[model samples]
Structure formats: structure tokens, C-alpha cells
Target chain A: MEIKLLTEHYDKKEFRFIEGYKKLGGYETLKKAFSLKPEEIINEVKASGLRGRGGAGFPTGVKWSFLPQNGEKRYLLCNADEGEPGTFKDRLMMERAPHQLIEGMIISAYAINSPKSYIYVRGEYNYPIKVLEKALQEAYDAGYLGKNILGSGFDHDMDIYRGAGAYICGEETGMISSLEGKKGQPKLKPPFPAIKGYLGQPTIVNNVETLAAVKYIIRDGAEAYRKYGTEKSAGTKLFSVSGNVNKPGTYEVPLGYPLMDLINNECGGMKNGAKLKAVIPGGSSAPILTAEEVQKTTMDYECLAQMGSMLGSGAVIVMDDSNCMVDMLKVTLHFYHHESCGQCTPCREGTGWIHKIVSSIVNGEGRLQDIDLLEKIAQQMMGRTICALSDAAAMPTLGFITKFKDEFEFFVREGRSKVKEVRAHA
Target chain B: MFKLSDEGINFVKKELARYETKRSAIIPCLYRVQKENDGWVSPESVSYLSELMELPEAWINEVLNFYTMFNKKPVGKLHVQVCNNISCCMLGARELTDHLCKTFNVKPEEISEDGKITISKVECLGSCDTAPMMQINDDYHENLTPGSAEKIIKGMLNGN
Candidate 1:
């Protein structure tokens, strides 16, 4: 893997500081980028084929290309509001290399001609916000952000906007609402954030990882950047692996890397001798995979899709036989219900209804018909909304209920969780 | 004034530091004070935040009034934050949340009398593995059962 292009100075605590950042060649790539034409940089990104690291996997270059050709005081918004469940890599990126994101943003803003930029961070990331705010002040002092950035004559100002702990705000449009000081809810589409966003200007909302990698994209030409990963999914990706593992932390692997290697080598395998049961390759939004399927999969956008799952936010949640799918599904459903933002009715109500059905099954009050009811509620919730939050909520529920129905039914028939209670019953 | 914790005071100072031009730290500062004051940003604290952000009382008041996260009303001593996100929802957090409200004898977001307990539904707590988790005043109790919920509440009441 590319040791620390994104996580280059992770071992260095000083990298979190401004002086340390400059010493380690931070903003050097930005200086190189400013010399080249903005369109050239965007084209390079497109050619590289780097997808959005935040769940949706939208084409990063294409998202940038959506900006209007004419300059109208555009905005560059960094989606650091990493509120996805099972994801902490963004938080680590922000905390460990705050200046890297700042430098990347400056480069990206320069390319997009966005005079103003904001990093919408999660409120609970109080420390990283402090780290970033500190870094911004340093960037301003260095003239990397404010008037005449790096003598390139590009005037850009960057700020950190804290989100009030809402998961939906992680959505690009939802972030614009929060940045505009409105309730963090997704707006109707047709005017994606690229066309209309953040006070109705041409705004480009890129994920933290996507923006941070821009420096590397500029430093190494598109050909150089595509050297590591598969042709379609170029560049290294960071996977935040958590749950039921001996080593639960963030590890960077090239796209198309073996999923089994990630679990066994990077994570030190499952805790104890317990056999692997299932895997959630992405955040809670992605479908759960049985152990056999996870081994056959690779860590990337296309590979995951082929496996009937997604490489969402790269939050790898590994589960052993000790865990209960029924108990887990209930948790996933409950999160979607709480964070639905009440903007879309189906997501708002359907999430709660699904949670009710799942919990009833878990609590042993479920009826046989409720399993079908779960599928119906999920089907109605999908593709019938303004944003994909509904789909994110529904797809996982459908996957769990359909894949592990026996465990769920077993829980319903017996008033106890199958995984936990079955051992006692034995 | 004398009652704010260090965090609340820091929030006020953070807000007040913006006295030059309307500070952006006002709402978060007020939130900090409310957080310290057992989930109620008092009128006095609002005034303090207003002066800090250099914003008018009307603007500060709207911020205080808006969003359920910033509690203007007094929260109960035992603050319970139930995960209502998709994962937790699929896991049955709603039923347990409803169960909590019934058992506590209070509506969602309501702080019970005598300051014994309060319950509210909140965004995902990120602990999806132990779905159906609740954050009680800061400590997260995951994989909740009604019986376990009752036991925990009883223990909290008995000062356990």
C-alpha cells in the first residue's frame, strides 16, 4: 500500500500542528496544483477514476465537473461530518492530519474557483474540530487560504462548521442546509449540490478522504496515481474496521485488495477461535455478507456491488458466530429511525415501523407475518425519497431479514435472542 | 453565573470572545451552558450567549428556541438518549424507547418530576453492534432489554 499518502504522517503527532505540517511538505502539492490549469486537475481526477469515499461512491471528478464554467463565487464544502455508523476513519484523518485536509481543500477550491470553503464536522468530534480550527488559523497565517493564496492570486477563505450530531447531514445537500444555519435535512434533488448548494451557489461537496487525496493526485500525475489499485478503482483506500476482531482500527489497503487478508492480517482475525459469521463491508448502510461471501469479495466499489453489497464509507464490521444477526438488525434499524431527519415520510415512519417489527422479533413478540411486513416496509422506503438515506436504511434491513430469517424467526418463536440465549438453553 | 461548570464557562467565553462581530460560537456556547445546567439553557445563559455572539436577543432566542438538541427546558437528572437511527431502528430501539417513556411516566423529550429520569430519542449513537443502545447521562448501555432497562433504572435510582 502507499504508506501514508493519505495517512503519510499518522505516526507523527506533530503533523496535527501547523509547523509540523509545513515541515513535512504539506501544501507543496497545492503549490504544484496552482501552477497547472484547474480543468487539467479536474480531468486528471476524472481519468484516475477516484470515487467518493463517503458511501455513495459517486465519481469525484464528475462531481467537480458539475460546477458551472462561469465563476459566481462558488463554494467548496468538505463533508467531515462523518456520522456514519462503524466509521471513524474520517475522524482519524481529521485528527491526525488536519492540515492535509486543509491543503487538499485549498487545492480543490483553487481548481473549482470556490472563494469560500467550509468543513462541516460532527459536533461530537469536539477534539478534531478544535484540531481543524487550529489548523485553519495556521493556514490563514501562512496565506494558503486567505487573500492571494501561495502567491497564486487565488483568494479563498476556509471555515469549520459544526453539525449538531445528525447522520442525514452527511448527505451533500443535507450538509448545505446545516451550513446555511437551517435544520439539517435533505432537500429535493434535480439541483444536486454541484449545481445549487450552500445558499444557492455552485458548491462542490466532497468527502474528507476524497479531498485529502487531491494533493496526491496533483503531486503524482494521473498515470502515477493509478499505479496501485485496479484500473477502474484507482488509488489506496482506508477501511475503518471495527467489531468482534482482535485488532479493530483503521487500515489503508489498495482497492481490490483481498477482503480476507484485511480481516486476518490487518485485524488479527476474530477474537478467540470463534469462526467468522458475517461481515458488513461498508457502514451500517451496506448489506451484511455471510462469511463465505466476504472471503470471495475484495475491498472496492465494483467488487462489493458484485457481491450484493457496497464499499460504503469503508467501515468494515466483522462479526463472529458469537453475535446475533437478529440483535444486530434491530440496532441498525433503530439508528436509521433516529437519524431519518423527518424530511422524507417513508424514511421517517418506515424506519420506526421496521424497528418496531425487528425489536418485537428480538423481544419474542413477533408474528410470522411480521417478517413479510419488514420486507414490504423496506421495499416502500427504497428509491421513494429525496435522498438515499431511505435506501441506506432500507437495503440493510432487507438484507438481514432475507439472509438470516431463520435466526430472526428463531428469536420470535422463542422469547430470547438466538445467539445469546441458545448457548444458555444448551 | 456561579452555577456553570468549567465546560459551560468555557462555552460562554468562547461565545463572548466573538464580541467583535456576531460570534459563530453563540449557539454552541449556549448549548454548552445548557449541557452543564442539566440540559436547560437558562434565560440568563441565553443573555450571556447573546452578548458573546454580539447578536441581538431575538437572534439568540431563536437559536435557543430552535432544534430539540439544544434543550431550553430543564432535563431530568437521568438523561437517556436512545439511538433512533436506521441500525438501531431495525434492532427495535423504538419499542424500547416507547417502553422507556411509559416506565418513566414521561413523554419523549420530557424530564420527569422530582428530577428522577428523563427520556428522549436521538440520532444514531454509532454503536450499531449493540443496537438498541441508550446513553444514560454519558454512559452507553447497549443491547438493552426491558428487564435490563428496568434493572439499570432501578440501580440508578438506588444510587448504584
Candidate 2:
């Protein structure tokens, strides 16, 4: 069943504006949040067990607690750069509920005592950026943002920084680098964002969904918010379902919702009743799951992880039987190659190398040894980069080659895709 | 002699101050240049934006080249970009892109003979729900068949 917490007002077009959102009793949580002490709000979220809805799945409250105890000016960045392939839920939330995000950010900023925040949105989302800009203006006018918000004396300033199409910028430090007017590249950790980020200031970077959910946590209190999802993965999540599904779109469900049920109940079953072959349960970076494995899987961080996959960004890409695994890997590798920031040697070279080998296989130039060679190259690429882009490229390559080795071997021997009706290449 | 319009320059000025640092405004300013110019950022406009924003020329150029949205060269009036990534291609995005290219009598990333359209197969635009979608400039034409996509392009060619 669809448990619409953050997305309840999405169907209402008026919810985009402050007046409509206010009519739906929006920002009431912010007013209520102001009454509690900052530590109390932090403790409430900590007890709620709301994990980061971004790919990482870290506890949001625990991440906030990492902020230094001193009154050093910190930054709260909302990672709205939704560039992960197959992920579009963040775009929907921002387009439909900009104020919800802004209100949530204010409460988070108040809890962390950070005076400044930025929503680093992707540039291609021109419409969403315009929505957020207008909503920020509305927030300022209504006294929800800016100095002395609601006369609570918790001053804050929020702004939107547009990201210009580099996928790596979705990473928090990469986002911080982009916001600081540099190339969108990831920085070394240990002096993590909480310690040093974005012009050497302590920063708290949260995904758009993670920040927006804070409102609900504040509204219903921690216990009520934790009621929907599993014990560890509490609260509802929005899954961006696409590919061969009959109804391909965003659906909100509890964390432990069955992956098969999401397909049958929400997506209206497979398109044209095609049989499911494989599924990329997370975004492109995650490992692929076979049809049999997907049937037993749930949409939580722990369940997918135990299955040797991840619930990355909750982008469930469904592939039907007619699709060729070799062709799909080629397309996916091409994306990572194009988006690799070229800062890390492993990612910069490994992604291109993988794309070349995969493209050659698709173009009918693969040796039998090249199959294992692809896996060897992909294995070395993992955990060797400044960022996970290397691993992102490597993980999917490993998943595709291992799970669908038959399709790949068939292509290598016949020089034509076994599944594709016509020759896709040559 | 590449330059922004008076209004475009003014918008760039406001964007410079819109962010915490002037360098952060490079993306928005480059977007303004792409909008003012014929849908692409020329080499000279990099220098022009460098001077206008008062940021380093290398910095402006780095950001311009890093992003796919800021076209480095000229595109057609109707810059049709089809999302041929995994999700879209699984359905019919590749076939749609091929059909569009054949209809326009141009290869991918090339302008037609009449220069009315340019088709390029791009990465995903996050609109995976509506597969086989194309972004013609700022607007999206989703859930497309070959015939429907052709009709939309022809309508554009006929000044619709």
C-alpha cells in the first residue's frame, strides 16, 4: 500500500505555493519545532531512526550530532542535484513541495545552529529551480526564513545554487566544492564535511528527501514517524520506478515494502505483461538482482544489503525478458565514462576502459578471454578512487557480468545479442 | 566581439552577487550566455563571461566544459535531445533517436541540411517514468512514438 507521508500533498497543485501549503497546515511543524530546545529536536530525530534518504542511508540525527560543539558558523547543504540515473523522486518533491523542503531545512538549521544553507539543485531542472526560488521568496516574506524566523531569534538564510550537470556533484563534498565555485569534484574524507567542508566550514549536507522528512518527524513526533517503516529503516520512502513496468513513475511506500508488490500493485505489472528478467533495485551504481532474487527482496537498506545489493537512491529500474544485458551494460558504462570528473585516476581511466571493452563487445569484437578480463578490470577499480564514482562504474559492471554471464557469453560467441529481436549493432 | 545583451549582462551582474562567491555564479552566467547566443557557448563568450563575471578565464572554461547542458558549439533552433540511457533505451529510446535522425536527414549531434533541427542522444534527464522522452530545448516531449515525435518536430519546422 502507498503510505504517502511527504507526498500526500503532491497531487494538489496548489501545494507548490506557500498559501496552498499553509492551507494544508504546512509550516505548522516549524512553529511547533521552535518551541522545543535544539537538543530536544535533535534527540527526537535521533530516536525516530530516520536514515538519510540519499544513497548512503546514514542516520540523519547522528550525522547532525557530528557537528562540533563550538559556535563556529556551519553550513547546511541540501543535495538536490538528483543526477543518479533512474532517480527522479527528488525532482518531484522539490517541484510539488518546495516550502516543505525549506521549512524542514529551517528546523534542521535551528537544530544544528547553522546560520546559512544552500539547496544545490541540478541545472537541467530549470522548472524545479524556479519553483524553489519563488518558494524561498515566499518563505522570507512569511517570516519562515531569514533573521528572527517566527520571532524565535533563530536567524537563518537559505539560497539555491544551480549545479550544471556533473553527476559526481551529488556527493556532499563534491556539492560543497561546486558551491564554492570550483570543479564539482569530491574531496578526501576524515576531515569530513562536519569537520571541514565548503570553504573550510563545518557543514551538514542532507539529501532533499532526508531534509523534507524532518517536518513529518517534528509534526508527528519521533515515535509516530517511525511507525511506517521497518525498525532500522523508519518512515516512508519515494521510489522512482521506471523501465518495463506498466505504470512507470514515483510511488511512496514503507521501507520494507516488497519489491514485487511495488511492481504489481503500484506499477500495474510489467508493460505488455512482459516477464521480468532482472532488476537494478537501486540506482545504476547498485548490484543487479535476478528475477527470482527480486521476488524475495524488500525495499529497505538492510534487506537489499543482505541480498548483496543496495537500496541506492530508491531508483528501481525493471528490465523485461526482451532486453539484452550486454547492450544495457554498454549504455550504463557510457554514462559513467562521460560523467567521471577525471579527478581520480581509477574512475577517470577505469570508466573509459570499461566502456571501451563493453562497447567493443556490443560492436562484435569480443574475445572469450575479454569476458573475464572485464571482471578483472572492474574488480581492481573498486575502493581505489577519491570518490565512489569508480566503484559506481565497477559495481554495476560486476553485477551485469556475473548475474547475466550467459547473455554476455552468447553475444561474444555469436557477435549478436541473444535476447534482442534484431541486431542492435553491426 | 561576442557579448551579452544589456539585460543579459544585467542578469549576470545580479547572479554574481546572488551567490556567496562570484565564482559560484559561473554556471548561471554561462546559462545566460547559452540563452543569449544561438543556444551554445562560443569560445569568445568564455572570455566575455570571464571579463563580465571577473572570474578566472580557466575557471569559467572549466565549468563550461564540465557540464553537458552548456553546448560548446552551435545547435539547431530546435535542439532535440533524446534520453537514450538504460531506462529509455530498454523501451524504444534508441529506435526513437534513430527514427528522428533519419527523419531529419542528419546523424546524431549534427544539424539538418536546412538547419531547422539538431538531434542528439543524451543521458537520462531523470524523467524515467515517461520513457522514450526528448527534451527539445527547455520543454520535454515524453511517452513518444516515432510518428508522434516526428509530428512534434514537423510542427516545430512549420513554425508551430
Candidate 3:
């Protein structure tokens, strides 16, 4: 069954506008939130146990607490740059319910006491940006945003910052750099964003879903909010189901929902009645899962982590027996190679090296040793770069090689796919 | 010699002031340049934007080169970007890309001979649920077949 906590009103076309949203009990939570003390609000969020949905699975309240209490100016940045392949839930959230995100941001800002905030959307999402800009204007006119919001004496200004295009910009520091009008590259952490970020001020960057969930946590008490999800991974999350699925779209389910139920029920099972071969439970960076492994998998932080995969960004990309794993890996590797920011040597060189090796294998020029070489290169790339992108590239490379070793070895040995009758592109 | 229209200049000005930092305005300003310069940002436009925004040329160029959306060279009026990432590829996006290129008589990343369209295979465009999709200019055409995509392109190519 769908949990629909955040997406309950998504089907209503009028929900996009402030007036329509208000008709459906929207922004009432913001008012309720404003009535509570800021510290109380923070405490409530901490009690709710909402983790960062931006793939890190970091506890959201803990992240807000990291901001130095020196009364220094801090920034709340909404990570709307949904560049993770197979993930479109954020885009859907912004497009269908911009004000929901806006309300959530304002409440988060009020709790964090940040005077200013930004929604850094990807450049390709021009349509969603347009919707947000209009919704922002409506929010301003309605006094939900801007100075002295709702006369609560908490002054906050929210704006949408368009990212030019790098996938790396999805990284918090990379987004901060882009917001500062520089190359979208991730900076080294130590001070982290809480200590020094976005023009050297304390900044709290949260995923769109994480921020939006703040409203519900405030609306329904922390205890009520905690009831839907698992003990650690509390509350509902929007899983973006894509690839060889019959009904692929964004589905909001409780954190510990069964992956197989989501596929069989929500997604209407594999497309064209093909047998499920594999799945990438999270976004592109998550390790791949075999059909048997996915059967026992639950969509949560602990379950996926225990299974050697992750519930990263909740982008479930399904693949059937019709697809070739090697070809899929080639495409996936090419994306990392193309999008690598080239700042860190391990990610810069390693992404290209692994992509080249995979390309060679796909091109039928692979030696048997190339498979081991990929594993070695990927192992070195992990935990070596300034950001997880090195690991993002390596994780899948390692996952594909280890779990689907037969595909790589067969491709190296036979120069064509063992599953599909047609050969992959030369 | 590259200059934005008065309207374009005004949009850039507003965007510069819209953000906490003027540098944040660079992406929006470059998008304006792309629109004004027929779909791509030129070197002259980069220098012009740098001078206009009072930012470094390096800063402007980095922002421009970093984003795939801000095309560096001229693109056809109809810039057909086929999504060939994992989900889309699983749903015949590559075949769609091939069909588009063949129908237009062009190679991937190359403009058609008549210069009406450019077919480029792109990564995921975030519409994977509606797989085998393409972003032609600003609109996303998803769940497309070779025939349907061809029809859409023909309509756009003929200005219909």
C-alpha cells in the first residue's frame, strides 16, 4: 500500500498554486510550526528521526545541529539538483508541489534560524524552475516567505538558484560552489558546510524530500510521524521507479516497504512480461542487486545496507532479462566518466580508466585480465577522492563485476551478450 | 560584437540581483545568452557577459563550459537530445536515437544537412518513468517511439 504522506495532494492540478494548496490544508503546518519555539521545532525533528534522503542517509536534525551556535549567519540550501540517474522524484515534487517544498523550506529555515535560503535546481529543469518562480512569488505575496514571515518576526528570504548542469552539483559543496558562481566542484570537508559553506557561512544543505518532510513532522507529532517507518529510517520516502517496469513513476511508501511489493504492485511488475534479472535499488551510485537478492530486500537504510546495496535517493532502476548487463554498465560508466568534475585525480582518472576498460570489453577487445583490472582500479578509486563520486563510480563497477561476473567474462570470451540475441553497439 | 537584446539584458540584470551573490546569476545569464545567440554561447558572448556582469572571463567561461545545457557551438533550431542512460536505454532509447538520426539524415552530435535539427545522445533527463525520452529545446517528449518521435520532429522542423 502507498503511504502518500507527501504525495497525497500531488494528483490535484490546483495543488501547484498557493491558493489551491491552501484549500487542501497546505501551509497550516507552517503556521503550526511558527507557533512552536525554534528550539522546540528542532527537538521535534530530532525526535522524528528523519534521515537525509539525498543518498547520504544522514540524520537531518543532526545535520541542523551541526551549525555552530555562535549566532553566525547560516544558509539552508534545498538540493533540487536531482541529477542522479533514475531519480526524478525531486523534480516531480518541485513541479507538482512547489509550495509544499517552499513551506517545508521556510519551516526548516525558521527552525535553523537561517535568514536566507536557496533552492539550487538543475539547469535542464527549466519548466520546474518556472513553476517554482511563480509559486515563490505567490508565497511572497501571501507572506509565507520574505521579511517577517507570517509576522513571526523570523525574517527569511528564499530564492531559486539554477545550476548550469554538472551532476556533481548535487553534492552539497559542489552546489555551494555553483551557487557562488564557480565551477561545480566539491570542496574538501573538515569544516564541512555547517562550519564554512556558501560564502564561508554555516550552511545546512538538505534534499528536497527531507525538507518537505519537515512540514509533516511538525503537523503530526514526532511520535505519529515515526509510526509509518522503521525505527531508524523514519517516515515515508518517494521512490522513483524507472526502467523495465510496467507502471514506472514516483511512489511514496513507508521507509521499510518491501522492494518486491513496490515492483509487483506499484510498478505493475516487469515490462513486457520479462523476467526480472537485476535492480539498482538506489540511484546510479548504489550497488546492483540480483533478482533473488532483491526478493528479500526492503526499501530502507539498514536493510539495503545489510544487503551490500543502499537506498540512495530512492531511485529504483529495474532491468529485465532483455537487457545486457555489460551494455548497461557501459552506459552507466560513460555517464560517470562524462560527468566527473576532474578536480580529484582518483575520480578524474579512475572514472575514465574504468569507462575505457568497460568500453573495450563492450567493444570485444577485452583480455580476461581486464575484469580484475577494473576491480583494482575501482577499489583504488573508492575513499580516495574529495567526494563520493569516486566511490559512486567505483561502487557500481565493483557491483557489476562481482555479482554479474559471468556477463563480463562471457562478453570477453564471446564478444557478444549471452542474454540478448542482438549484439550490443560496436 | 555579440550582444543581448534589451529584454535579454534586463533579464540578466534582474537575475544578478536575485541571488545573494552576483556569481549565482552566471548560469541564468548564460542561459539568456544561449537563447539570444540561437541556442549556444559563443566566446564573444562569454567575454561580453564577463564584462557586463563585471566578473572574470575565466569565471564566465568555466560556468559555460561546465554545463552541457549551455552549448558551446551553434545548434540546429531543433536540438533533439535523446536520453540514452540506463533506464531510457533499457526502454529502447538508443534505438530511438538511431531512428531519429536516420530519419534526419545525420550522425549523433551532428546537425542534419538542412541544419534544422541536431541529434545527440544524452544521459538521463529525470523522466525515466516515461522512458525513451528526449528533450527537444525546452519540452520533454517522453514515452516516444521512433515513429512518434519522428512525427514530433517533423512537426517542429516544419514549424508546426
Better of 1 and 2 by TM-score: 2
- Model 1 stretches astray by more than 4 angstroms: A1-3, A422-426, B1-39, B42-69, B75-160
Global Cα lDDT for candidate 2: 0.91
Per-residue accuracy of model 1 over A1-426 as CA lDDT, tens digit each: 334568878999889988888899887898899889989989988888888988888889999998887857688989988878888788889889999888888888878888888888876566788878888888888778788877788898887777666777788888877666556778898788788887788889999999988878888887887886897788889888767777777888889998889989888888786799999899989999999898799898888898888999998888888778887887677677877878778988999999988878766788888989999989999999999989998999988988888887888777777777522100
lDDT tens string, model 1, B54-155? 667776665455455666678887888886654455445677888878777888887787787878877755555566678787576877886788788878
What TM-score, computed on C-alpha atoms, does each candidate reach?
A: 0.83, 0.98, 0.98
lDDT of each: 0.79, 0.91, 0.91
Pick the winner on DockQ between candidates 2 and 3.
3
Q: How many backbone clashes does candidate 1 have?
A: 33
**Clashing pairs for predicted structure model 3, backbone only:** none
Please compute and give the TM-score of the first chain of candidate 3 against the native first chain: 0.98
Point out the worst 10-residue segment of candidate 2 chain A by lDDT: A417-426
- DockQ (Cα-based) for each candidate: 0.18, 0.68, 0.75
| Model 3 chain B: ten consecutive residues of lowest lDDT | B108-117
